[model samples]
Target: MKAMTFKAFAVVNEIDLNKIAIHCGIPKKFTWEEPLILKGAILESILGREINAGQMVLIFSFGSVVFINQTEPSETTILLKFIQRFEPDVEINNADRYTDDYKLHIHENESLELADEYVMVPEFEEFYPELISTVLAKSVALEKTEEQLGKIHDRLETMIDRLEKGKLRIGNKELARTTAKILRHEYNTLAYIMILDKPEITWSSSTASEFYDKMMEFFELSDRYKILKSKTEILYNIMDGFSTISHSIRGLFVEWVIVLLILFEIVLTLLQIAGLLP
Candidate 1:
């Protein structure tokens, strides 16, 4: 009998769950006797267990239900070609985005994809070589954009600093940061998973809503700060210009006084020469 197996993983780096299963990574050598493959979340919840790092879970079944399907007609065919372009550490092993019901097995190898680092795009006009400073702000809306990213940076720094340094673990799907960070690239919007020290892998979509909501509020506050700062800068620039103009005018008046004094002395000398006035 040909049985298909699906492999997946999650991290309990900081989850506050009771470890239902002990250090045994995989339950069985193969799970084919029951012929029923249960969902990972359900299995996890039912068992009241937390999956740790470097753990493997194997789910076996007769056929397979796969997610992460290729959108294009030839996506499957070209998958290999595309995969070759990226490093194994950067590869994503999935048939689709998400699945609740499926037959699957999971191995907790240090897959390059799980612990991969994502890059942050900075929003600065000076950084853009093609655009001048004056036009860059208008084109990129830099103040608005920077405020958004600035809030993210600030929030992350604050969370990391305020919270005890540890891994984030989860028992419920409701606190998943799956949508905000993984799919959406909104890293600062991850929900509160119990924090513990461990190699963390957060792939749950459970915290997306909460994360997004928090981030939206953060963005609004940042926008307001940016507006206030812009106005302050403008006011300061105007004051500086006024001071410079005042100094220049003062110097011009002094020069005019000196010229008039020279003219007056010349007139006195001419009057003395003509003997018409004292």
Candidate 2:
């Protein structure tokens, strides 16, 4: 069986594909829906590696790059450094922190089979790399988002603990910051990463569509996205509850201040009536 390995990384918020294309002097071949394909001599020159047959790199605008049949960690490090030129804020460390690996095997007389572990195909098509990269890129992106959500969840739990102890304290500024963080995450995952949207290629080709569906199921992408949405809603409700409590606390404090000022005025009036004040 002829096999190839694929690795994908979600390293940054986004990549400047136009800038990279300008730098490479390669004509812009990528769109928001399609990833830029690098193969043959130019890819070799970029990676500073030998040109192996069937080796390719796919760069996505959503801050993901898939390395097909390129296994070396040093190769990834080198390419990410090059990529950092286009996106100065690109954190190379995330390449390791958020990544997914998949394998493709071509077997004679075998039908296309996709599973969480690997995919087996009768023959590789020109579109296989793009399709596979799409799945891998989103999968790793989801992984990163999942990690982020986990952190938020843990923080909420900490707040809950404080509440249980009757010591919950959060300022309006902190609440605003937290709300913005959650909203940003929701927008990034839904609008930016677009895990729910179908790839454009899949719309034109039924076979590709079928393959993409199978790959999505294999990765459980939709289900995970739903879970993320549900978690977001729960967090929202929690924050809403906190907001209500905060407002109520502030209102009570204001009322107490008003009552104390009234009492002070009454006391002064009583003293004046008794000739205790000039």
lDDT for each residue of candidate 2 in 33-127, tens digit (9 for 90 to 100): 67777888878888876867888888888888899988577888888898898888878875788888889888879998877768999987767
Evaluate candidate 1 by giving its C-alpha RMSD to the native, one decimal: 24.6
After superposition, candidate 1 runs with Cα above 4 Å error: 1-219
Q: List the residue pairs that clash in candidate 2.
A: none
The clash numbers for all candidates, in the given order, read 21, 0
Report how far residue 26 has shifted in candidate 1, in Å.
Answer: 53
State which candidate has the highest TM-score.
2
Per-residue alpha-carbon lDDT of candidate 1 for residues 55-130, written as tens digits (9 for 90 to 100): 2222212111121211232332232222223223212343222122212122344221111111112221211111
lDDT, each prediction:
0.29, 0.84
